[model samples]
Target: MDPRVREHAEIIVDHSVDVGPDDEVLLRGHPVAEDLMIAIAELCGERGANLSVRSSSSRVDRAYRKAIDAEDISQSAVSLAGAEATDVAIAVRADANTFETSDIDPEKTSAMARVNKEIQEEIMGKRWVGTQYPAPANAQDAEMSTDAYESFVWGAINKNWAAVREHQAQMVEILDPAEEVRIRSGEETDITMSVAGNPTQNDFAERNLPGGEVFTAPVPDSVEGEVHFDKPLMAQGREVQGVRLRFENGEVVDHSAEKNETVLTAVLNTDPGASRLGELGIGMNRDIDQFTYNMLFDEKMGDTVHMALGRAYEDTVGEANERNDSSMHMDMIVDMSEDSTIEVDGEVVQRDGAFVFEDHFE
Candidate 1:
């Protein structure tokens, strides 16, 4: 076993979920993450914590999606029961084949997603963290050598996460009190929305490891104008790039993508809430400088911001903020490294990939 696998497991157990004595820890991951899961189990044993693990495979997922009818695909009672009974839930995403389900019909896959949304939300309510374990397929998808990709994953994970959180909180401080936010990047991207009354979350490895983003829910029905997302977006096990969206009254009235336009169309048609904005997040993790085409890392890259379409997280939008609800929470990334400025009620907060008040980050 690679030493980093043990180190990664230790971080997840000690810091991320903080598994302690007599705790019921539910560890879920793909087969590629078995080593890390074993490491976590060993650590849990040492701490006198009980650990339950579920190892999955892409082949199994592919077979199940193909075998089951869309309507028949429903949430697992056993999974929900496990979530309810567990004190800590750590999910490892180790994709043996990143695009394994790219060929499946979007509607079929979306149906499964919808069915599992509530169970997922229940798991999210627990002390949980989602991290990735590097696999050969992920390296190939990222177009890097396995060793290089492993280095990248570890580098992003083994950071001073606490320091990153402290730095991100400063940006949250600025955003929490703001009434409105305007994002502009030349003529290609220009969008405005209200953040008033929504709580801001400073993410630093709480929900996601390698995390460094400050986010909040946009006021439902408050978005206006057009925006273009240049970064490649991963959703429904496929990649969509060069997205341009025009919003009116918070609804995605018109949208286009240079690649996978049909998939994009199907994504919007997933449900009513799929057409509205759910989250607005600013990436602040300077260490994650490159895009791996993985959302967990890409959305936290410096000089970038992402907007998600679908259900709002209760940490930002309260449970009562139920107007926006859907199985889809697709995040589309927008680069802010050049000719872009984020204004909070007419005052500049970030300009050209850097925060306006630079000292706060330093």
Candidate 2:
């Protein structure tokens, strides 16, 4: 076993969730993450914490996807009760099959997400953290060798998290009071939204191991103009490419996708709030520079920007601040490494993927 795996577990249990004696924790993840789970369990046990582990297999998910219909896809009442009873929740992702559900029905997939809305709400309301392991399937998706991927993953995970947190504080300071934010990338991406009274949340590898982004929910009815997403995003068993959304009065009035247009359309039609912007995120994690086709890391990649459609975080300036609400939260990335600028309150904060004021981040 790699010593770093244990170290990673210790960091999560001790720092991420802050599991203490007599604390009740719900742990769930792929069976492939057993080693990391063991280390985490041992740490929790030594701290006298009670943990319930749900070791799941990717094949099980595949079976569920194939066997279930939209109406059949509801949250387990038992699981909901369990989550509500737990003090902390830690989930690990180490999938053996990244595209295990590629053949599943898109509507059914959306239904599954809709059904689990309450469960996600309860979990996110708790002290929770979700991280991923370096699985072979993940490496293949990132188009890198397993060894290279492992190095990339671990290097991003283990960092000067304190520095990262401090670095992100500057962004929060600027965004916390800003009313309007504008993003421009070349001529294809130019969108404006009002943050107003929303609270800005700065993450530094806490809930996510490779986390380094400052995000906030935008006022649902204040969006204007259009934007294009250039990154490859996988959604509901389908891959979407070249997504473009045009907004008016804060609702998506027009949208297109070069690939998987049907899936994207179905998602936008999921509910009333699905066509609105929920969260506006600015990526600042310089350590993670590669596209892994995984939103967990890609959404935090430096020199990139991501926005989520559907539900906004209830605690952080989303529904908490009267932002958009829905059962879904789909994040899509857009490149901002060059020919782009993010202006907060008409002040240029970042230009061409580099912060105009980089001192605070360093």
Candidate 3:
């Protein structure tokens, strides 16, 4: 019954997916986010949009995955059909337990992702947006109180998206026509990849609420060098930290992790494209100044860069460029707050997290 919850739902309906009259809107979220869902459903009703609600539960999913054999895991025809039929899909995340599926077999997780790739693609092809509802478990993971976490989530979500788009457009201009980009953080991370002919997407809370990144796909065979992602990320219900990857000819040749190495290995072995870079994104949302253990927000924090290891988005790749395809798209972040520079072509654009155009750039 918080005002921000209704505000969040309004953004999802009016700005994110833009549910119109007679549209089929599919809403999926945990029951904990029922208030927000109800707000969204009410808005959909007012707009004359048909609503299909799916209550997702991490516990239920964990039990199912634990009970099923890896080989027996298959895509649900109903799920695919629903995705195909929906005009707008809004997925809200509110985790009751961040590590609910940590005990599940990595191989089985990979298998499930592989089987559901089609469903994912079908949903992605629609007018869709994924946002998170501040939940107690997530707050604990972020090392923040519940009230503070709610404020953080809504502060990042309910904002001037147009201004964000305008601010991020500057980065898009630099990447859209660039031939190559180099990213470096201290001596541990240094990598270069070509972005020629790839379209840079300026994200501003449309597909991803709280979105404030400019992203593009790399040339499939043009990446070379090494990178150490100092930031930790949650993957497969486990925390993966200190990920270091060496790339040669756009494929990861060497990889290691300080934690959850097996999870990283499972992800890398998911498919052929899993070993290659799918996306190169620059975070420009200064409002999200802290790491919250949530990629939805962390990846958009200023002074950060994130790269996904699989499944390049269709819009980021040019028709002439090859799109990296995989069942997984895991984002890992690199801290650029100090001892870092993002070089476009040969010029330094961001030095120690300050873009050259920013007033603070030294």
Candidate 4:
């Protein structure tokens, strides 16, 4: 096994989820990541943690979804039981075929998401982390060779998270007490939302392996204006590009996509909260300098900002703030490398992707 694979597993077990003595750990991944899983399991054993491994196959999932009627889709009892019993849950993504589920009906996908929302929330309530394995399919999706993709993944994952926390703390301080934020990019994107009493979270590879973002929930009815996500994202096995949304009173009043508009429509129509802004996040990890078709990596790249359209994490919401609830939380990114400014309460903090505190700010 490559030393980097062990290092990746160490970060997941020791740093991300912090598996400890007697902890009940639920590990889920595809067989393609067996090496990484073995390393993690070994580490868990050394730590005296009990491990339960679940293997997933995208092809099998596609088959099941294709065969099942939309109305018959329901939450899996075994999944719910595992989620409820686990003390720590670690999910790894290693796709053999990224497009295996592409033909599944969007409505069926949405229905499944709706039914599994409870299990998702349950898992979210535990110590959990999600990371990606550099499978060939994912490498191809990112338009990089497998070896290059492995280097990229480990470079982003095996790092000093303490320094990252300190660096992102600056943004957390800026957003935590601010009442409102305005984001603008080129002539196509301009948006505003209230953070108000919401708490800002400084992520440093704990909840998300390779995490390097500062995020917070927007007040349920406080978002207004329009945003054009120039970056393309893979959603429901399809590439969605040029997503433009207009928000009125925190709900998406208008939406469109240059590609896969139907997927976007299905997502927005998933639930009542699906059309509202849930999270506002800023990417701070300069290490992830390139775009990957994966949200796990792309949303953490520097010179970008992301927003999720549903289901705010409870931790990011203040006791007094209303949390946005939905079955889905889809993140879309905007390029802020040029002609962009992030204003906090009317004062510009970032201009053209450089924060005011950085040495290069002009």
lDDT measured at residue 341 in model 2 versus the true structure, 0 to 100: 90
> What local distance difference test score does each model get?
0.87, 0.87, 0.92, 0.92
> Of the pair 1 and 2, which is ahead by lDDT?
2
Give the alpha carbon lDDT tens digit for every residue of 1-362 in model 3.
89998999998999888899979999999988888898999999999999999998999999999999887999999999999999999999888887888898978988898899999999988999999998898899889999999999999898888788888888888889999999999998999999999999999899999898999999988999999999999887778999999999999999999999999999899899999999999998888989988888999998999999999999999998899998679999999999999999999999999998889999
How does candidate 3 score on lDDT? 0.92
TM-score of each: 0.90, 0.90, 0.91, 0.90
Q: Is candidate 1 or candidate 4 better by lDDT?
A: 4
Best by TM-score: 3
lDDT agreement of model 4 with the native: 0.92
| Ten residues in sequence with the least summed lDDT for candidate 3 | 160-169
Off by over 4 Å in 4: 61-77, 103-118
**Residue-level lDDT tens digits of model 2 in 201-277:** 99887788778899989999999999999998988756899999999999999999999999999999989999998
lDDT accuracy of residue 216 in candidate 2: 89
- In angstroms, the error of model 4 at 212 is 0.9
List the candidate 1 regions with Cα displacement exceeding 4 Å.
64-77, 101-118, 318-323, 359-362
Report the C-alpha lDDT of model 4 over 1-362, residue by residue, as the tens digit.
99999999999999899899979999999988888999999999999999999988999989999999887999999899989999999999998987888888878987998899999999999999999889898899889999999999999999989888998888898999999999999998999999999999999999888899999999979999999999998776778999999999998999999999999998899899999988999999888999988888999999999999999999899998899998679999999999999999999999998998889999
Question: What does candidate 1's lDDT look like per residue over 24-74, in tens digits?
Answer: 988888887778888988999999998898888878888888888887887
Of the two candidates 2 and 3, the one with more favorable lDDT, higher being better, is: 3
